[model samples]
Target: MALKFVRGQGDGQAESGEGQKADNTHSPDNKSKWLVNYKDRLYRLSYYTGVQLMRFGKRIRRHAVAAVLDAQDWLLEQSAETRERAAYARISLRRTLEQEFFSPVRAFRARVKELRAEYDSAKSQGGDQMESFLAATSQELWAETRKVLGITFNYVAPLGAAALLFVTITTVNSFSFGLKVEYNSKVVGYVRSEADFEVAQAEMKKRIIYEDYIQPEDAVPRFTMAIVNDKDIISTNDLTDRLIESSGNELQEAYGLYIDNQFMGATTDGDSLLENLNARLEEYSTGAKDEKVSFVKDVQVREGLYPLTSIVDLRNIESELDKDESEERIYTVQKGDAPTLIAQKYDMRYSDLKELNPEIETELFVGQEVLISRSVPFLGVQVTKTVTETEDIPYEIEQVTDNSYNEGFTKVSVKGQTGEKEVTSQITYVDGVETERIVLDSRVVKEPVTQKVIVGGNKPLSYIPTSGGTNNGGFIWPVGGNGGYVSCRIWGYSGHTGVDIASQPGTPIYAAAAGQVVTAQYWGGAYGHYVKISHGNGLYTLYAHNSKLYVNPGDYVEQGQLIAAMGRTGRATGNHCHFEIINNGRYLDPLQYVG
Candidate 1:
């Protein structure tokens, strides 16, 4: 065998190996012979192993190829069988659908088509018949309309012609002759109608003032029909002037004072009269710093012709303007109305009222007519002034809710006080009657202190009964069982003397404490069906607006005992209990006693 030299051999072992090598060198022939034999054996073993491995590999490869070919053939066979089965299934499905679904659908579609054809044919025939019927009806209606129109024309034509002829004749006659107006048998002028003559008379009456209904004899006019041309017809104004000229009075152009369009008096000097009127307004406006003064009635001066008899002396004009005129009006007396009160209502003296109403000599009765003079100044002046005065400012309430507090409990933490304010207003007075007042500006003299009120928002879950009785009396809610709440507070404002506990209609009401029933009856006024209980020590409780009362007067009831039912009666707006607590006839706040 071959000697192997290990790598980890010591130097001494290497030296021994060298010696052995030298010895081997000495037996080189024997070593060569052994090595060749070893080589040859090794080569034979290698060649045999390689041949065996090649043979095994070839056999394995051939088997694998055969297996692969078998698998491909099986796969192809399976694929062909699957394709055939799929084609057979597709053909069978098509035949099944054709027999079961498509055939029936086609038959139904054909039936529908036949029905549609029949419906269309019938519809076409109906349309034609309807069109023929409508055409025949339209022709008949047209014929009837023509016949009726022809008959109406035959009857109406003659009457229309007669009406036209009569209207034409009446119009021609109306335009033919005018009225000849003659004043005092002397011809004044010709007017188109008698209305113009009447207008002239009215104008003459207005322009001339008659004493004791005395008028000129010739002032009366006569109207006669006369043939006149268009140029001969005069207007109402022109006829009025002509009649005035022929009145045989000294007619001078003067300024006429018209008060509210009614002629008052005539003045020769218009400027002086207007100056006097302005002086009157300035005199009334003297004391007012910011004042607007004007006549209550529209006063105007116009230039016109007036008879001497109609003109008043200029000196007497001022007296006439200062005179007060009153219209005769009937006054019906009311019950409890005295003669003095009636006189005061009209701003007249009692003596003057008695003189005007002699029948009201003693006392005034209802429905009795009383006469009173309402003075109407001829020249009234209206003076509007801007006035400033101190006024009271109403205080406001500030509400604060506390959830910790029990519901239906209210306490005023700060008392409210009225403040002072200086207010400037524009006040208008017409003939001593206040017509309008408008606030112009306001300044606070003192700041108003807001009233702070704490209201409870928390509602108790249930009522906890108290142990005490009438001596140390305790009150409970009038509306038992969580059915009510304090809708309004006690003594909230003027006239509200109690608290309002809102509940359902017919809800049972309970007595606040043990007490003897004093009054239980329907008030018929504001209290409605009510109950009053008087507890010992001058204590009392009142319940109002009840639907039904369970306890009668003089009955005793315990605390939280049913006494009545809630309702909306008398002046109540809804179902609620108006509860009040009184001590010695003095009204007390219920919230102070009960929650």
Candidate 2:
């Protein structure tokens, strides 16, 4: 047996005696008697166990080492393959052992141990039975181990028969048995393999422990708040009183409701506070309405006048109306009011109000009444005037005489006189002497001199009729006269057609006839302080270059009623009214219509 062991160790050195000699130093002693005795016992035991036993034992040990090494090598091969497939698969052996094998070892341990026990028991049993049992056990072990190793093994013939039976049983068991895992009523992980089963079980256990140890009181709920409206409050009692007055409820119910010092609504307890308050507010709001009064104040005289040709009056009606009307209510001039005052009160255009009382004059009197209506129109104009006068002129006259000779053999002389004239002259004598003479002539031509003269002066003029016109009746010219000069004419350009009326700046432009205002605007585009009135005669009058307008869009206007004060506006060379008379969709010269 010692020789056999030595020979086994020296098998690679058979050709090198020197190598054998060197190995001998590390070898077990052969000369010692006890060593010899132990060797003899070992040899007898080997012989009694059968030559097959000795060979089988050596084979078993060799196979065991080879199996482990092969499993490791297979694992490495699988890792290399996995790496080639996906970069993330290049896991370390330690990680693989923990995740794929050790982690799942608990789930698979029972079967593995059973297989191992069966193998050991079969080895103890003798003959054909042992071979069959070992084969079955090895096959079972391989199946369990293959999951971790990613490899397979083969069995001998007799063993193969038993292995087939084991495989059948194992497959059936695998299909029938499974672990179920649940999380928060939802399934997140499934475990069919031992590795996966073990990991899931561990994770579940850890989560259970954490949940059991934590306290609910340690966590707090989150909250957020916001302020919807903020306003100053002068007094709580005042607010409460207002709420009570406006609300159809008692003081207790009205304690919390007010809108900017006015009573609005009532509030109940928290449940229906908003609902009740809103309802009360709606009722209060409905009660409020706007009331407009046609205000008139007499013109106050300051104890002097050239009949008071000019006067300044602040209407104060607008401010009063504004104050009397509810915030939610709109106040419009119904009748008998000046558009300028109404517009000033509302910060709107006089032209906008002009539609309400078209016959109203630009030169409004304190006692004259006009209408104020609801439709707030946008028509604003600014009036500005400048007056200038000519300086004093002087007059002068002179006289003159002339000398002449005619029809004489010896210097016959003649003289004649001409009518009133002024002249100065000088004559030269052949003796280097000079004579001076003067004459004057003056005569006023009284036969209605027919020389053309521009009729109107440069001073600004207005055409507002002073009498015989009202908001209802069509306007009658306040002053009797022919229409002013045809200073300019209307034409078409840039696909636009309109007329330009050249009058002195600050001319009072009136509504051509009874009409409703359709467009009233100031300072927008080419038309400045412009107004368009629809006369129902298939005619409309356009007035532009106004320093002021006195009507609104929807009000009825009478013919020849003052609508605006003419002045220089967009594209105007000087102060003049750009007037247009449209009849049947065609523009006629204002000169043709006005007269």
Candidate 3:
């Protein structure tokens, strides 16, 4: 039989004429034929023998299976000369394809149109040199166009792209834009969201209240918010709280004070008010003051983040944030207790404490129970302020002495008159507690009148009763706390008529040597609320600046009996009792008899 190569057959195709039907069993290892069919690397149908002619021509100039039929028909109809010329054209085409390259892009339709237009223009001008130049240009353009077309249609390429982006180290990622806050050229904090920035700012304000103590408008720190990309980002976690704490710490110092389970405000100081007390406790525990001064009860000084007021104005702090966290506590008076001391121990004002307990005697008993409260502010900051103010200046009294009068008697030759003055003073206060003062300028508006007195210098020794020199044995100490400090000594200064004994308001006053309540009402003016008593003896004891009086005019109060409470009423700025021991309507220093 003659050897032949043949293409595989499709279903229902007639068998070849002189070939007998092969056996039904086909071998997978057959060199020329196989039973199975599959797709080849060219993505064409492949039999055991060869590949299918489903696609033809350049892979770049993709042609369908149907186009191959036309190509084959054209080839078959070409004469020898045409056929050979076509082959040469194909060779040149392949050379162009191999020489140049292009990315996947739009077809070079512009070049085709350009070439055509140029040809048309040259043809209209009718120049051989121009025509020849255009022909050459056309040939070059043809190749370029084919290259573009090749990439556009002959092959599938992925779209390549590029982009431009801006990044910076001063940015962060968040739902909203970033906010950067700077203070005195230093970056204090950053926030991603607007809400977080607000919170951060609010927290920062705590320092103003707690530390710098400046007005809100005087706050030097500032904030800035802007947009940023992810690449230039940092974190904003707990950012508000962190910034708040950071700023507050920078502004103010902190301390805590405690006393044998009780705290006293006697001699404590702080950068603000609280720290001094707390630090005193710390010092006492460490033996810095007096180690031998042991704790009367609980002997431990607790360390804790004692909350403080914010640096912003107290009014602002109270209004800006919620203070649902405040609590009220009650304290019982222990031995050696006074209203002022109790107020200081609980960190409350003497007047405020007295106001809280209006029913209690100004003087306190050892077992007396009083109500005191501690309110923890939101931010642990105390706002201090420097304020310029004009205040009333008390006129001075100048005394002129004459040696022409009798010994125990004096005459006012010229009456004294008060004057006015203009004073510019700088007052420093923390949370409304005055700490320091400076007088910037002062001018006396009205000159004060000096009192000329004819005094008994050495005239004669007058007969003075010796009976008024000693105590009647019925008096007792009235105010509490270290037995009441004689802040203003008896007639210690000019124009001071009586002794001002300092004590916390609400401290009790006793009936000096069993007296009758001659006057006990709201005595206005500098004495504030006061009480007067007639001892029934030739002498009388007057207790001015009493916050409350338990006795009526006709009521008899025994020695050491609680008759009134100490207070800062009328013209008084603080809690103290102005006491006087008088005989025959003559005022004398109470200390003389009390001592």
Q: What TM-scores do the predictions have? A: 0.34, 0.22, 0.26
Instruction: Give the Å shift of residue 194 in candidate 3.
Output: 28
How are the candidates ranked when ordered by lDDT, highest leading? 1, 3, 2
Candidate 1 — worst ten consecutive residues by lDDT sum? Answer: 1-10
Best by lDDT: 1
Better of 1 and 2 by lDDT: 1
Largest TM-score belongs to which candidate?
1
Model 1 residue 387 CA deviation (Å) reads 12
Candidate 1 local lDDT, 488-568, one digit each (tens): 897676688899999888889999977567688886456778999866546689999898899965455778889999986
What does candidate 2 score on TM? 0.22
* Regions of model 2 farther than 4 Å from truth: 1-488, 571-573
- For candidate 2, give the lDDT of residue 314: 24
lDDT of 1: 0.69
Residue 142 in model 1: lDDT: 60
Residue 221 in candidate 1, Cα distance off native in Å = 3.8
Q: Order of all candidates by TM-score, from best down to worst? A: 1, 3, 2
What digit string (tens of lDDT, one per residue) describes model 3 on residues 371-443? 7754643322222223344455433333333466433244556766667777766654322334456787888
- Cα lDDT, all candidates: 0.69, 0.41, 0.50
